[model samples]
Target: MLTPEEWAIVALSLRVSGVAMAVTLPVAFGLAYLLSRGRFPGRSLVDAVVHLPLVLPPVVTGWLLLLAFGRNGPVGGWLEAAFGVSVIFRWTGAAIAAGIMALPLMVRAIRLSIDAVDRRLEGAARTLGAGPWRTFATITLPLCLPGVLAGLVLGFARSIGEFGATITFVSNIPGETRTLPIAIYSALQIPGNDDAVWRLAGLSVALSLAALVVSEWLARRGQDDRAGHVL
Candidate 1:
């Protein structure tokens, strides 16, 4: 049984991870589609930028985010002036950090699925009088749904475990920016908090494992479905 405080932490973590997924999903899909199908100028550059966070140290990513989205940063300053909204040291900022960290994973998974789709099927649909948007909605998206779902699960898991970037972006303010990973770190810093640390750590591991298992299962199912479609 978790203490009330621990439960609150868990709930906040879920909310942040869920919001991050919601915010990232459409952008991830759009990038995946563009990368898989479009041949625009700077395509490689865009792809590299999309995956930059994956290669950069999390702290570096966080630092860049702070520089870009902090109140004094250009984008952040404009947003504040225009909308009167601020994310600094808030849960929203933490969600942004988590979403960014998870974006590459989501985009890569969805792009792989999109690439596996047969072009001929799309062409056939177009020939049968379907417009591009209709063909994609009816043929392409359905075939790649499993991968999208898998990506969502994988991204959510990544968001749940996000630490370095989140801490850097939002700091570990309880009831706000402190998520599972941050909570674990906080527990570790306190003397004689071994029991709390163990409990939180165990919960985090279990959640991550479950998400990974589901993601793997979804990916395999997608592959099997594609194989059957081919046969």
Candidate 2:
């Protein structure tokens, strides 16, 4: 039985992870499409930049985010001054941190999916008088859906599990930025809190498995959809 506080932690984590997924999906999809299909200048550079967060230490990435989005940081300052919106040490900050941390996984999954798409199908659609956008929507997009599903699920899982970047960027404030991992850590720091830790760990495991199961289902459904389309 999760205490109210524990439930709150779970709720906050879900909110943050959901926001992270929603915000990153379009951007990740765009990047995946560009890297997989479009040939342009600085392509390699863009790829490296997109995957930099994956290679960098979580702390380093978080620190960079802080420097770029902190209250006094340039972008953060401008947002606050213009729209009066603040992300520093706020729930939005957690979302941003989670988004950046999960982006590489999302982009990688989506990119691979896009890469696996058969260009012949796209070409055939174009030959049938389909424009670029029309062909992509009818052929390429549908074919790459499994990968998109995989990326979205992976991103959601990563966001839920994110600790280092989120904590560093937003600090663990109760009912605000304290997610499951943060809650578990807090329990460990307290004496005779092993039960709480175990429960939280169990929840994490369950959440991960749920995400994977959902992803698998979607991937299979996508395969069926594509098969029916082929028929």
Candidate 3:
């Protein structure tokens, strides 16, 4: 059981991760479709660049984000000047860092799903007067539902554990940007916050387990649906 403050951290973690996943889904799907199906120059480069965060150290990624999106940075300057939105030391900034960390996983999962979709089904839909968009919506999308769900859940889980980048980018300000993992790290640093540390750890474990179970259930459901159609 968590204290009220600890519980708030857990809830904030979930909200941040969930929002990150939600934001990543459509973007991932679009990127996956372009990678899996589209033809263009520099495609390979684009793919590699998208996956760069996967290989880079978390702190490096965080620093890069800070450089690119900091209040004084180029894009950050433009965004702030245009809309008065500042990402530095903000919850939204934490989510952005989490999203960046989660992007490769989301893209990989979605790409695999897009590849698994039958091109023949897409052709069949086209043959039946479906436009490109309609065919994708009615055929390709449904077939790739399993992968989409898996990617969303995986992205959420990744976001939950994101600390190095998040802390570096957003500074873990309490109640604003201190997620569960951040809280855990801070508590463990204290001399006698053992109870808080243990409770946060337990919460982390439970959340991870729940995410795993949900992913498994979604994958199994997809398989069962496929089996039913086969029968």
lDDT of each: 0.95, 0.90, 0.87
Q: Cα lDDT of model 2 overall?
A: 0.90
Per-model TM-score versus the true fold: 0.98, 0.93, 0.94
lDDT of 1 by residue, 35-68 (tens): 9999999999999999998999999999988998
| Model with the higher lDDT, candidate 1 or 2 | 1
CA lDDT for candidate 3: 0.87
Q: After superposition, how far is residue 85 of candidate 3 from its true place, in Å?
A: 1.6
lDDT ranking, best first: 1, 2, 3
Which 10 residues in a row give candidate 2 its minimum summed lDDT?
222-231
lDDT of each residue in 32-129, candidate 3, tens digit only:
88999989999999999899989999999999999999888998999999999998988888888899899998899888877877688789899999
Better of 2 and 3 by lDDT: 2
Which residue runs does candidate 2 get wrong by more than 4 Å?
216-231
Measure candidate 2: CA RMSD. 2.0
Candidate with the larger TM-score of 2 and 3: 3
